[model samples]
Target: MEKNELGMTHKKKEFSEWYPELLIRSEFIDYSLVSGAIVFRPSAYFAWEIIKDYVDKEFKKIGIENVYFPLFIPESLLLKEAEHFEGFSPEVAWVTHAGKSELSERLAVRPTSETIMYYSYAKWIRSWRDLPLRYNQWNNVVRWEFKNPTPFIRTREFLWNEGHSVFASEQEARAERDQILGIYLKALRELTCLYGIVGKKTDYEKFAGAVESYSIELVMPDGWCVQGPDFHYDGQNFSKAFDIKFINKESKEEYAYQNTYAISTRVLGVMVATHSDDKGLVLPPKLAQKQVVIVPIPARSEDIDKKLQDYSEKVLNTLKEHGLRAFIDNRDNYTPGYKFNEWELKGVPFRLEIGKKELESNTVVIAIRDTSEKKGVSLDKLIEAIDNEIEAMHNRLYENSKRMVQSFIHNIESYDELKKNIANGGIYHAPWCGSTDCEIKIKQETGAKITNIPLDQSDLHGRCIYCNKEARYMANFARSY
Candidate 1:
């Protein structure tokens, strides 16, 4: 009698059940004592570390230096920006007392860091040279979300990086916003093989105090078009509130143009939802903590078991020497069947199965998790084969995810058609006039909101999806998580 990990129920028949069940059973995350937060298990935290390490390097290259800021913001400073404060006030966690004494003013656990950071920026920046202040912070933010908490998605507190920058001119500020967003988009593809559509948020849906905002929308297994990561163009919004002004080249004191963006742990959720299947998790090699796992198959005879272990050790060393993250499963108590199921459930990008037939043939079986394809490779060429297989697996995951995301998109031409298909999940691309009232009506009629307005929009001369008014842009509509 052994306590083995549990496999998830059928994902297709019961996705909501399957999703959270696998996350907990796989030891990725656990529901914490805290009502709305989670303790990331070692397995899940390591994956997040891999992403942070890569992104941290990227930020350094672009001259965006990292620094830490106090987690609590005084109520007075938080309310300096009325819109930003109002938007997050409901969810803000306030500290009104210290031990037993009442505090003079409440301090808010930061829902976002704009107000606090900009207040310091005002004192730090004195002239034109200080104009391009590019600073980044990797920290936790508290929002006290009330909705059902999902691991790595909706939580009261989450790990996220907020990159704030200042520029002397409008052009520089705008360009930097787009450039930083490009970095995040690249991070998604290279890190997780997740595909998404980049679009501008409507005025109503844009960041509370941002001049403009954009999001990358992906279709989950349940067909909801959810946003994982997003960026904002602050455009002197916070600078004005906090008086972050500097002397210009022309010797004029002016407010600095600014921008801030946040990419959170929720991205890992998107990767899991998009790529994992009925069998178990299917991880992208780049972010997988243990990229490759080799399981040694013990023979019935003692002599054969000894030979297999020796060979498996050599194979494990070879893979490690090639700069691969790998592990060898040589635990005697577990059967080979148990090992296979265990690694597959963990989503190791590739697995090595070594046995007697392969030893005589001088070959080893390679299992590709993403495609569930197994092949035999010559022992002499094992390193080269694994490298190539890993690359192929990454490409396949990206292509398959891209295809699925494209399949969920339906272009709507009629309001009745929208109502008929609202329940059927997916992103509906439809023409709409730029009107908040029209947008509200659409939400009332259909639960879906206009998530984004695509950057490269189609010609817009038709009637709005709701009001029959002139269509201004092709907006993405979906019921989101």
Candidate 2:
């Protein structure tokens, strides 16, 4: 079947099926020959570039430098951090032999960079002057999972930036963790048009061996709550494990405080699931490679052909002049409706249609993808209209999803309520006494685990929804992806 013929007829009707289909049709990713891996096509690659460029700049603003680490870890090194190794052992892919010759020690393909990256950090730090060593690496990690891989969301191999840093004191490390998360919050808003909940994960859900882990969670259209980007604070746990220490001003040695964070291609999955609709992807202007698509409507009258082409080029040039990612579809074989469908499925933010009627009226008709609104735009005000409409659409997407994030959250006041509503999907906010047993009970019975405790809810409390004990904090719960 031709690409346009498929036309995304089932998107809103069946989103789970729609998302993967849109991803494949839109040329974002495809299943690879290797199990649990995907080939990132241009659409996915370019979007990652925009994200990488933005966050790289933001990281530099806070003194985080970029670095690269080896992709293989020695067996001895991987065993250094006991808790981390134990947590990751099942998923680690070990290289037992070097093709023809068997190696003396096994090397595990990097599941996460902590073991290898920190091995280097131990060598570089000597004194208090080298206290805070902030570095970030853009690379791929392999977690060989047994579950069914879903492209960007759950692939065995995926691209991500793992940021690692060291600090002199626990206070300094904790502050850096939050500072890094703040940078992520800004980037997420500008890049994805996402508004997410800020919180710290429960002890059971926190990062392996980290003192505390924090997250910015987003609710998708399918009612799943996923952690987007996050920061982790390691209070000497790793430094002690890896023996990373520095001399203090008093000439005594103390373990260095450390942290690590990640923002992966998984965000792409969340963005598509959050903002997209029936037609296809609804990319924010900032994330799109080509934000404006100009389709020259075919002229029925023979004399008006040149006028349509000429005016279309003029409008396209003006958009480019204003620094927009704009392209004009001057294909001779396709109809205007076909061009519209093509760009709509690709999620171009705005479509400018120029036809004989629009030329005669000295105006252009634009289709806003976010709202599916079409309006006639005056020729004199074309530039301003395009800029305004693009911004308006981003704002509209943000506001709509922002409301959905709040509205979908079900506040449960009792255990029965948790059991009844959890399977239906949505963020469940419930009061909880700080107890792992209660959390386990909820998960075993209802299949919802502790996602996070919002920073705002730390002080607010009541009776535990399950045990009726004094509540420690209100927490967010959901069946994660």
TM-scores across all candidates? 0.97, 0.96
Clashing pairs in 1: none
Best by lDDT: 2
Candidate 2 local Cα displacement, residue 198, angstroms? 1.0
TM-score of 2: 0.96
- The Cα local distance difference test for each model comes to 0.84, 0.85
**Candidate 1: residue 337 lDDT (0-100):** 82
State the lDDT of candidate 1 residue by residue for 1-481, as single tens digits.
Answer: 3424356655744877878877876677888889878888876888788788877888899899998899889999998989998899999999999999999999999998998898899999999987689999999999988888777767888998999999998898888867777878888888778888899999988888999998988777777877767888888888888898999988899999988887888888878877888777888887788888888787798999889988888888898999999989988888888877777777888989999998778789998887778999998899899888878878888888899888988888778878888797888888898999988888887898988887888555577978888888889888887
- As a TM-score, model 1 comes out at 0.97
